[model samples]
Target: MDTQATSAPAADVTSLPPVEVDDAEAALVEHYPRLVRIAYLTLSARLGRHRRVLLAHRVAQRSLPRGRRVPEVVEAGTDPAYAVVRLATLRGALARADRVDGWRRWARSAGNAVPVPPRVIGLRLFPRAGGSEELALDRALARLDAPARAAFALRGVEGLDEESTARLLASAGVAAPRRAVRDAAMSGVNASLLVSGEFDPCVLQARPTDLVRRRQHVRAGVGAALAVVVAAALLGVPGSDGGTEASGPPGSAQAALAQALDPASLLRADATAWQRADRLDFASWPARGDRTGDQALLGRALSAWGRPGASVHVSATAGTPSTPPAAPPRLLFAGDVDGAAIVLLYDGVRLVRYAEPLDGGSGTALDFARVDGALGASASAVVLARSDGNASYLTAPWISGVSLRDLLSPSAAPQAIHRAADGVTDPVPSAQAATDANCGTAGATWPAIRLTPRAGVPGLAPFVLTDLGDLAPAHLTYATGRGAVPAEATSADATAAWAHSACRLASVRGEGVRTVNTWAFADQPLPDGAGTAQWLCTRADDWSGDDHVLVQFLPPGSAPDTPAAVSASARSTAACGPLQPGVLSGVLWKARDGRWYLLGAGSPEVASLTATGGPRSTSPTRTLVVPARQTTQAELTGRLTTGGTLDALK
Candidate 1:
């Protein structure tokens, strides 16, 4: 048996000499399992048990120094070697937990470049199960944040006192070590519970993962490999087209390929097509980019659309197919913008944007979005370039005016924004701006592009579009009253209603959103003649036909931009949409007289409302009011006029 892997003796450093690389290695080797356990407990529990196990071992293995170098001396009364390694382990786990945002997440999504521990096929590994006390400890640790978990693990498992744990946490770059210690103490778990064998990752339970399903998957993989081998062999034959052609006859493939690459075959609309066209969409867009006449660039882009190279980064919105177009695609734009050569193409169903570095570098990017039935407001703009948290748009040809509007400040006049001759607007702050700031605060502003179509364009309304980190910006629409149909949100009432709900858009950013409709479903009167309140529902629909709905309550006398309290929210449901057409939600409100009340409201279809739990009350109408406390936790339900029961939106 390997003693280093199986056992770790307690370190005695009362009279140890100055530490070196070899000393660190010795300490790491003897205490490797303990260090792994510490990292496992410190890492975020959201990563799941298998990944946490592997990541903990990987972090522990990398904690040792690479070469013979002088190690930094830690404070007295502790082994410098163990202290250095422990700090490194804690820092690595914390960094991993915090890397789920910003560019790191983008890089991982685009290229899968985020480093991860090796994964085992058809096997799962987890720490051996302990008794109820150990399970309670695990649950308690999971409830705390990463920093607090680190504090607890160090103080408990490592047998360190509060001062040592704080010092170690500080050395590991924790900003508030004392606060983290306090949070850990408040977890209501005894520190001794953390030292149990249940938390020991080195003693793990291994199990095979779905053996029957794995066998089926293996057979399918083998069949796929065989098919690839046969296709390669056929392509190697002389006088063959090298598998470049579509699945058709010999000459038809050549004809299709020629048409796809030929610029003259592209459907270019006349500059004044919108004035005479019956349908107002991309079909009326005239090719306007500077490089539209560059045949070589267009050819390259066309070829890339059919078959992108291995280095090309290709992404598509949900429900958007990445396959090649069946016919010659229309060229919308092809120009050099912000150091990148961009080409935009539209087949009747999809909008494809292909971009490559202007310097001829390897960072080529291709994006696809579904615009099959886009018309009017939905087809008003497409994102031309997004860099440094700002986005520029290529507006439709009929758009004669462009301006920036802050949805959170409806009273503010629309600010004029610069638009180029080619119709590309100047860079405006993207949705990322709202997410980067403290949401719902006064500083958070959501900038929306307001487009004004030329006069005499029937059925076209001036509308606003906001970038949601996609090739196409999501259209914003609104409705004023209950059971009203949503329309272009350009009226003052719509703008004012959106002001209280705009900050909620941050939740749906970067989610392939296509359109967001805000509807004021109900207005309720407050108790004791305080004032009236408004209940609004904002539904964000994604490209995949799923919707995210949020119901908010706007109290009387709130600031114009004050974010409304979220009463309820749900995903992938039609609770607040035309399908369901009914929504019920409640909020605990404090009146001006220092009395708390439970306020509930439902859509027009709701005949009665009821409040349970902390406050029990019922109303024969669509609104409910009851006296309550600040800490009151209540459940709201409604009975529809059609005799069906409804629960509050979750």
Candidate 2:
């Protein structure tokens, strides 16, 4: 638009001046040299080195407006001139490229057709001394598909931050570009050593996030619990439809269901249903002949409902066309209620039958696309929504006649989900077979994986979080929250130690093939709060997924009105109690009687402690299980392992 040939230094373009199109264009023109280098290196592998220089020039100039009017920059934080020109360039190149992957593009030309090793891509962009390694790197870059090549070039080569690279690639029309950038960067870095001949790039282990789709549903549901905590405590719980079933195309039943319910409205309806209905049917089954078939179990679930100030409202855009299901498509509804968040499922006509209150405590988030994709291949779709509180996760399907209570219970593993019968596998058959075969004696369980450096472990690459438009790196950010990773945490032994120290009870669950490790924290009393203790639970896995606090518990009779104090030392001490040894203390408080009390969740083997009259060691003089509400403590003489925290009961 601004064709005025004026010379000036290049503007950073990080923050372009609005309404100053002429100046912006001039700045971009001045920066063309730098832009060309970026473009050439970024696109060369995909378009082949021969055409890279020409394509780069075209991409830069074409990014400029062809018409008289300059277009407004649609995306925030992007330079209007440069971003437009770069995006245009990418589009033009893609049009000409052969055999480009729609989702992950690559070059199809004979010379650049092989799968490139990521290390080679890195070296090409950031050329170290040219040698066999450089040649190898060139070969690798040539072989990579377009998306991976672009990712490596931008983040790995250009050294752009993930956010910047994702934005640039996304502007160029890549699906899940943010995810792709992260993978490419990590893979590139990991592959750097492979060129040394000591390591094989193919043998490199897959990052957990790499192999599995981040459990967006479960991740989001963690915060969903806080929304429903109050109402859920009083009432009860329960638990997607979209495109198609994995079996083939969408069947009549699946299509009818997707059409029957508006995704957002249906979710709102289900949330409201939990509050209003004293006795309601599970979502898996419609009102068949006017009798609520699962009345008895449904009643137990409903008992947790009926509290004031409960709200799980779906935004207008919720369940919009962002994620389209196929074959036997399932519907997903995720929102916050009361103060917590909840995810509900719809099998067309009814809600998911589980009927348990879904709650993810504070700081919960969801990725709907990942949830849909994980279940995309399953015949009977299973939704992984958080149960009331964060202590447990429910991986049950929305099928009629299925008992959620039994399925969720350890003894009655649902037939559909038991063993390898029904679980997530790679969309690619070969990849799926690799995972299945690896899950033999070495595999801990469906959800429990033993992280090892061995070659045979299933490759766990991070899948794209399609629904996470801007928060694609959320998983990485969460991982750094607690503090630095200790040296011991480098291996499985350290991770297991961390778990046993912090959680009295821990388990793993498989959602569409991705494994998430869940843990329950001991109930610990708030500082200076004699009557109440706190219960906190979390979930995480190796690779990128970080520990998310699933539930935050405040015990009954505790100082509910008072805000909690920051007790870093107390929390650290309780996580792995020196006095308690292997026993993790949930909460600790000193009673007015000068005796200290500790609370915990689950069934823990607590060693006995004895104290008698006149402060002399004697036969157990006093011992009591810390009740939810207690202001007085006479003495400490008994082994105490509290049965339930506020969330554990849920």
Candidate 3:
């Protein structure tokens, strides 16, 4: 608020003469820009590491009345020095590391006291020495984001005052508090020394003076961890309501944003509209983004849809907002895979859009408001199985057809829309036909999209719903609207072919309206030609309505246990070693135990637990039969198909 005539040169502000006017209207200013700059540098240094630290440094007048250097900077006479004199001890530890990531991973693991998420570097205090000292710093300096580390190294490691530090690093508004700066330096120095194999500088070693603070190492990163176990394994980190996120980083709101959605992995391949998540607070379920019941499931699928190599970009601003924007809402995110970038937009949480690259690689922008309006018709409502959308997405009073999970059938590879009794003719009619009450597929008004693109598939042109209008493109960053596409069961021939294959596809549930009429139990007791059988009284067609199946599995030479317990985890683990080499290695199954178990072991990077498989896969044996068991329930209780499997890389 310097109320005087503005001057472009930094010299003018830096050379202000001492002048004060207490008058009410006497042109006045507080130099908030400089102060903010001070704060940004202070904090950025505090939250050390060279990654995209959100600090922005702006040149300012250096007329600080109380002139003194802040604690984070390294003084020339500091012990264990060099450019950063107070850290010679840190040099010793670096010699031992084989791979930086291994050490880093251990340092940031959940079990560690203060989860130092590899970013937020904290405090450091160096011992004094004569004029020249060698500060053996944690050379892993390569890891710290350039902005953050520079801010910290200059201020904390270079002995510059906050303003000088701010100017030095170039981003100003994000300065951290003096104490926090000290903490960050200490954290950095501690980590450096520990990793360097010196005196584990973090242990406080009696402090030898009135140096830093009292108890606490919240975000236990290696830097913090060194501070912790080195000094009581610093405790729990304060997360976003959990940990103190570096008092906001050192860049402009725009820069932090750029940093946040900086990478491609965060977005869909070349998506103009990518998705972004400001933070992962949802895993903790903060009250603001409530999204109850099915809404929650929708939220989960949408959020995880982005793939590392996805062309569409995605991002989100994690704030105090209550509910997230509706589907097809344009968003921004950490780039598709790298880190965070600012330009991209995405539908952050619910879906991943795949689009052909725009020329020069700007993603195709979607008109989100228009699209949101279209999806609006089915918000929290049940959608008919055959709702229409070809050119433009169909909008009307309806129920969302199905969960994304049900979209993909082997025959229905890209989609999970099961064959409705009436085919694509009347979704509402088919859903209503089941209960006979015509209550409209219960919430099918618009919320339940029985079929949408698989959580991460991509494309823009209309393919399915020939009955709808063409979807108009939105100007928003991401795909704005979705035109209705026909479910694979567009006709009887297609539906029948897919359904027949799904039905005949063995003991493991494949696709379609299939119910378990009976299950042929393998590995369990078998009498004559009959193996232990867990038969479902329900037939494949029972999937349409009140159909239920009976299931009983018996071991090959043993008597059937009155009740059996199968753990998807155990089965998955066994399948890796025990079930492999068999022809059925690739068969997919929804275990009676409730876990969706897949038959084959995939790539080494992913293939391990048998009970747990990727969301989709193929089955080797399709024909399976067993003596029918007489039971009322379609599936046993406590049964779950390791329902939440990781999405495949493709």
TM-score of each: 0.62, 0.23, 0.19
Q: Write candidate 3's Cα lDDT for 92-114 as tens digits.
A: 11121112455575665545575
In Å, residue 553's CA in model 1 sits off its true spot by: 1.2
Give the poorly placed runs of model 3, Cα more than 4 Å off. 1-16, 19-178, 188-650
| Global lDDT of each candidate | 0.77, 0.32, 0.24
The C-alpha RMSD of each candidate to the native structure, in angstroms, is: 13.2, 23.5, 26.1
Residue 246 CA displacement from its true place in model 3, Å: 53
lDDT of 2 by residue, 358-469 (tens): 3433233322222222231111232333223211122222222221111011232222222121222111111111222222223212221111121321322211110011
Q: lDDT score, residue 448, model 2?
A: 18
lDDT (C-alpha) at residue 493 in model 3: 34
Q: Of the candidates numbered 1 and 2, which has the greater TM-score value?
A: 1
lDDT of 1: 0.77
**Worst-scoring 10-residue span by lDDT in model 2:** 465-474
Tell me the lDDT of candidate 3. 0.24
